[model samples]
Target: MDHAVVIGASMSGLLAAAALHRLFGRVTVLDRDTLPTVDAHRRGVAQSRHAHGLLAKGREVIDELLPGLSAELVAQGAIRGDLQRDARHIHGGHRLARGDSGLSGLLASRPLLEGQIRRRVSALPGVRVLADRIATGLLAQDGRVTGVRPADGEPIPADLVVDAGGRGSRTPFWLGELGYEPPREERVVIDVRYGTREFRRRPGDLDGDLVVIIAPTPEHPRGGVALALEDERWIVTMAGYGEGPGLALTEFADYAATLPVLDLHHLIRNAEPVGEPRSYRNPAGVRRCYERLSRFPEGLLVIGDAVCAFNPLYGQGMTVAALEAKVLLEAELRPQAFFRRIAKIVDAPWDITVGGDLKMPGVEGDPTPRMRMVNAYLERFHAAAAHDPELVLRFLRVTNLYDPPPSLMSPAALLKVLRGGAPRAVPVPA
Candidate 1:
């Protein structure tokens, strides 16, 4: 293809642009937000102020797409530490054992991460980042997308158009207008609400750990997470589902204190607030089943949140987007092949997020027998992680998307769960 256009200059769009830059002669990325020059938040990103975890698998893909990117992040003040060893985690009402799992990633503000990638992608040969423009509609003719129509400008023509407009995308409507069936949607309403605030970090904050996580358990549905950010700062996010507590500036710390773990709340209570608290609601887990569509435009492919918006609590959005971008880099620009690849790319994240949401009372869908077994085993696995560092590493591997979820169900893992080894506050010595 000579030219490919990516709509929405979010992480997924940028990554897609980078992938296409090598194959196509020219690539263009458009976004509505006038992307800020500095490492600052933009109006387009709803969860920019929240805690974002670049899981192990995501870190690898980023480094693959932009070599030396991780180093740049760290040099620019991103904290680097073992995913488990330097972090505190509580799950299934027990603390996960701390130990080195050979997985590490940069902990930085969302803007910093996206800003760096945007700058790099913009500088790439034959790549253009156009801000202050929104894709008003798809340009289609003869069953193939011809380009995209911008809100205020003449249509930009292209051989292919990819939608990364996230969950708010209007691609389905555009498809309907083109006499094509939009992908059917699978939605599980979570009613998840979270508030985030940045805090000035000191050397001794959270006893110098990079992250303190009080994950939500069945008993205490409210949860909290704190991550060490660039420039001696921290971003703490507290979340709840259904009839949760108030998510406001005045109530942030109070909500944190109710978490299953105290370290997150304790740190935020003492740390100086650097910014006003901001809250965002992830109303549901939505997956547009594009793979199920019998017919789709040849020149159009949907990626990122435009295809599936995972539950934010899992931190799978960016990672899944990056993986899909990688797939786009290699796959032929055909609808069937593209949808198949992205479907496989999305399956893990969808299962993890959608399955978790369905477990909560009042949410939609009945858990499959296999899902019940998996969740039951995982609960035991979390309890075992308190005692067995190996089991903890295995759990982290699956959660980080480094390993398949089936790894957690291996006979060996099941035996480890049956054994239910010893317990310790910290599995590895500092």
Candidate 2:
């Protein structure tokens, strides 16, 4: 390919640029937001201000894409920890297993991680990060993309156009205008609101565990997550169905108090507040059924949130986007082959995010036999997790995209749940 245009210079766009640079002579990444010179969040990505998690699987993929990136992140203050061993979690009034499952996760602010990776990707031979630029629409001829139209400038010709504009992408509309059938979308209304704040990480927090997650069960629909980041700071995020208490520190305390786990409540009470609390709402989880489309435009591919957006609560968005980039890296970027591979890449995380949301009681989706069985099993599975570190490990493996969802339903796992019981309470932070 002579030229490739990637919309949205965020994580996914940057990754796509890195992948395309090898095949195309010139790769340009376009974004509307003024690119930050430092590690700071941008308006285009409002959720970056909230708590974000990088699963082990995603980190591994990044490492493969950019060698020594993980070491660089850790050197810059990313907290590296074994998923189950160093992190504490409680779900459905039960504690998860706490042993080394060989799964490792790196926790850092989204901006920091994105900044470091962007720098490396931009350093490549023919990659360009163009900021303050907008992709108004797609330029196509006879069902094949020919270029990109700018918001206030001339159109740029290209051999390929990758839509990485995320959930707010206009590709569907563009496809409609181009006389191609837009991919049908499947949605599950989660209506989740997130509140986040940064605090000073004192000597001992959450009894010295690097992270703590208080998951929201059907009975208790309020929950939050807190993690120790670099520079003696901690980031905490809480979720609710709708109408949060408020983002004020006091309001955050009130919301945390509602969760069955008191670790967050206690932390909210004692920590030195760094800034004003912020909250964002996610009305639903969306998956654009690109795989079902019989015909798609040539020289046009949609990746990342533009194709499927998962609930941020699972911290799977960036990870899924990275996986999609991996697919684009290996494939020839044909419509059917690419979409099918992308579907396979997202199926596990999408199912996990949507499946977990459906357990919230009000979210609507077809409760297929598999869904019902998984939900029913988790009730017992959570109780059993306290004693069986193996069960907790399995959950983490699936959640992190390290293993497929089917691994959780293995006969051995079911047997473990059958033999498990009530969990002990977590100790207060010393």
Tens-place lDDT digits, model 1, residues 1-430: 7999999999999998888888889999999999898889899997898899888898899888888899998899988889888998888778988888899867988999999999999999999999999889988888889999999989999998989999899999999999989888988888988888888989877777888877787677777788888888888888888754454545676877788877877887767788677878888889999989998988998899999999888888999999999987788879888988899878987898777777776676798876776667677778887988888898888888878888876878777876783342221111
Query: What is the TM-score of each predicted model, taking all chains together?
Result: 0.95, 0.95
Worst lDDT 10-window in candidate 2: 421-430
Query: Candidates' lDDT values, in order?
Result: 0.84, 0.85
Clashing residue pairs for model 1: 387-422
Stretches off by above 4 angstroms in model 2 are 421-430
Q: What are the C-alpha RMSDs, in order, of all predicted structures?
A: 4.1, 4.5
Candidate 1 — worst ten consecutive residues by lDDT sum?
Answer: 421-430
Q: Which stretches of candidate 1 lie over 4 Å from their true place?
A: 243-250, 421-430
lDDT of 2: 0.85
Shift of residue 405 alpha carbon in model 1, Å = 0.5
What is the lDDT, from 0 to 100, of the residue 426 in candidate 2?
24
Q: List, in order, the clash count of every candidate structure.
A: 1, 0
